[model samples]
Target: MASINQLTFIKPKQFEWHEVPAPTLQNDGEAIVKPLAVTRCDLDLYMASGMYPMQGPFAFGHEIAGEVVEVGDGVKGFAPGDRVIVPFQINCGACDNCRRGFTNACTSVEPFAAYGFAPTGERKWGGGLSDLVNVPFADAMLVKIPDAVSITGAAAISDNAGDGYRTVAEPLKQRPGADILIVAGLAQSVGLFSVQAARALGAGRIVYRDYDAGRLAKAKALGAEVIETQYSPDLRATEEFPIVVEAAGLPDALTFAIRSTQPCGICSGVSAGMSNQAKVPLRSMYMKGITYTIGRVHARTEIDHLLDCAHCGTINPDDVITRSVPFSQAADAMMDPDIKIVFERD
Candidate 1:
């Protein structure tokens, strides 16, 4: 077995790399991938800080783009040496949910499968933060990276960009040209992607609320009107947007999203923390006729279109990548507040 090194969270605020056996092709539909580039999901930070409860010693990454090194006998439309982006959610393409285009809630894998999160025991595949990873249901889970798209640029599409697009674009289709309110953070990629996706979806106006000046500035640079606020007392006082996205991954942001949206508007969230106890103004939502949906992204649903937008220069996803670090420095890079880090294997 080839030895693969992976970063694991030993305890709160601590991380270390450990050597383990590289994954082997366990099924006829699986493929072994050596990730070319990887980026931290915003959720990983929560798991690391003990804000989210997770079993210890699990592999710790989700977003990845890589080269396929091995393909199972039943794998089709892919081969060794093919460059591809792995969707963070695992799904069996033939299920009812998959057939209906709800791959994020696939029945084959537990509620959340991809990386970092504990497996549903249906598939042995872990997160993508290693030298090698086995991707089951390869035909449904992998998207071939376009030759025109750089590996680094394609990396975020596996999760962050895809989540952002799905969260913003999918719902906005029901109500186009509505004002969009985004609750996001500087360290979080989902917020940044929300801003870009909202703009791409042709929202009448994009208003963002965040405490980080850098995040606000970045949002502004991407054509969003940003407001810096503490989100205290009532976040609704800051702005009233017709459509809202809670990408902040905090309870407060969720509250803000429900309160700030206009009556009959849509609110979509990708905040992982919502799984825990979170207070939502149910009475307000009921009275206002507000619609809410939150969870893991159905990446395949939006990645190809998002990639097309990125390739055409209409939306530059690379603008959100604040820094790139060698894979060996993954832990330190995550701790760095200076920039959002993208880790690449050297």
Candidate 2:
């Protein structure tokens, strides 16, 4: 068996490069990939900081754009050397939910089967920050990176960027030129990417709120009207928007977003870490007839449209990356305060 080095999260605020057996094709439909550009998701910070409450000693990092190294005989549309974005979720395309484009709820694998996280599945699929990884459903889960998107820019297209698209793209299509409000702080990249997606998809005006000066500046640079304010449950939008996004993973932000939606409007909550005891503004939501959605992103379904926008220059997710480090420095870089970071390999 061949061995390779993988970044492992041994404990909170600690990481190590551990030697692990290289992945091999277990079936004809599988493929092996060598990640070239791997990006960190906002959840990584929570997980590594011990806020997410997940056990460690598992491979870390997942957002990936990689070169295919080997493919099984059954693999067709891809070959060795092909560059692809690996979705964080493990999905068999033919499953009922996957066929309906709900790839996140794929039934063929265990619930929430995914790479990087230790609890996602029984067998580790390995993390993107590794010498190699196994793609059990390559044809279903891997998307070829378009020529217009560089490898670095394509990294988060597999997850964060796609999650942002899910927030506003379809809603904007329903109500073109409608103004949008994004309440952001916790999920930093996803919030900024939401601004980028809204701009690319024809949203008329975007108002982004965050306490961080750097993030507020980035949101402003992305063509959003910026509002800098501390997180307060009392914070409320003076005016309702047809589309509202709550990326801050707090009950207060979520409630504020619900109250900020226009009548019959949609509020997309991208945060998943809010307390279970958080209260929903049931009376307000009911009276306003608003639609509130919160869950994991269906990345495989959203990446295609996101890549099209990227190809057309309507959005460049590369701007979301605040720091870039060599693959060798991934373990140390994880402890930094950068809003977004990518590890690159030659």
Candidate 3:
């Protein structure tokens, strides 16, 4: 049996390359893929640093852009050598939830069956950091990378970019050219991606708020009006917006996001590591008739649209990728404080 090296998380702030059995197509719907570019998700950094509680000894990547090396007999949409984007979550694509565009809550697989992390169910789907990965439901799970998009730049589209897309896509559709407010501080990629996504989606006047000078600079470079500020739980937003996004995973940031939404406006939170017990201003929400949405992203549903944007050169992932390194430097890149990093293989 052929084996490949996989990046595995051993403990907080620790990871190693380990040899693991390479995967093959188990059924006609499955396909074998070789990851070419993998980007770090904000959750990866949090989990690796012990900021987020997650057990390790699990394979370590989820966001990836890869090439199909082999396809099962039933696989029709893809063939060997096709460059593709693989969504983080596993879904059968034919299930009720998936058909309804809720791929995040796919009914065909055990709840939360995802790549790049520990097994949540009986099956262990390997992470994207491996030399090769097995993708079940190939036709349903894979989206070919656009010819106009850079393979390395599109890597984060697997998760973070899609997550960022959802922040502004629907809201902008509801109110085209509306100005948006994004509260970003902790993580760098998602918020920056949101700014670009909003621009592509026809949003007007993107205002990004964060205390990190580095992130603010990145936001400004990405065409967002940057606001520098500190986080406080009691913080109140002085400006109002029809669309608000909270990317900073802090209770204070969430509160500020809600306060910033105008009456009948919508707020989406892409933050992780927020306390479950955080309070919402129900009275204000009811009086203002505002809607707040927060949860895991249905990444598969938005891939094509984001790719379309990428195709037209409206949003370039390279703008947000602060660092790009060869695969051998994965360990060192993961520990560094760079805003966004991409690990690529030749």
Candidate 4:
């Protein structure tokens, strides 16, 4: 066991890293991956801050670009030394939900069963941030990282990048030259990924709103007309968008997207049910004829499409990754409040 299974948690802001037993393959279809680079999602940061409803000291992360260390007899597609991505959710490929392309809601596993999220009785898997993490249904769940894309670039593909790809690319694929408005708050990387994905799909006039000046600058660099706005319901009063995405994962941000969308426009959200009372403007949404979508990402189902863009350099995830650090200093990096943080192994 390399470094054992390390546990890192936020008491709510402070984090601790220590040794636990490394995970092992429990099933014939399972594989053990030693994560080479583990990335943090904004959700992790939010949970760390103790704002959400879940209790912690659970596995600390869910995103990674890692190397396969061991594989069970039933696993045929991957072997030791193969670099792969472990998506946050676990889906059995043969299930009805997975066959229909909804792995996030797969009937074979407990609802929202992923490596992250505080371990409830229904789900309990070690996070990928540790040395050796188990991946069940490995042949179906794991997606290989393209050689052209760096480990840092591929880090978020399991969830953030793939979700952002679906969020922007699928909607705008037919609407050539359509304009986009992105309201980004807590979902720092996905927000930026949407910009890149939208640009790759031939979007026009992407206008991004975020409070972080650094993030706004990164968005600007990615060809979006960026604005730094404080967190409020009134992010804007008049700007109507054809395609609007609220990757920030805030109810207020969703409301802001709803409030600003044009009639019959699509307003997609990156999060669902983070707040007890989100207070939607149902009347306004109905009047405007909005189409909205929010929830878990079907990462395994969508990885191929995104990888095509990545292979040709159509989307640049590396540009948005603001900081890279040694895995040992991950606690410091997590506390630094970077927009996107990728941790490398020794």
Predicted model with the maximum lDDT: 2
| Residue range 201-306, candidate 2, lDDT tens digits | 8898899988899999999988999988676778776889999999988877888888889999999989765355678888989999999888899988888889
Runs of candidate 3 exceeding 4 Å displacement = 272-274
Q: Which regions of candidate 4 are displaced past 4 Å? A: 1-3, 231-236
> TM-score of every model?
0.93, 0.98, 0.97, 0.94
Model 1 CA deviation exceeding 4 Å by range: 235-239, 272-275
**Candidate 2 backbone overlaps, count:** 0
Full-model lDDT, candidate 2 = 0.90
Quickly count the clashes in candidate 3. Answer: 0
Error of 2 at 323 (Å): 0.7
Question: Positional deviation of 318 in candidate 1, in angstroms?
Answer: 1.1
What's model 1's lDDT at 144? Answer: 90
> How well does candidate 1 score on lDDT at residue 159?
81
Cα RMSD for predicted model 3: 1.2
lDDT of 1 by residue, 1-346 (tens): 6688888767667788988877898779999999989887776766677666676767778788999999999999899999999877787888999988888888876776666666666555656668888888889888898777878878888888888887778667878888888887632778888888888878888888888888888889989888887766465544666778887767777787788888888888776463657777899899989888877677766677798778777677788888888888887766566435678888
What Cα-based lDDT does every candidate model obtain?
Answer: 0.79, 0.90, 0.89, 0.81
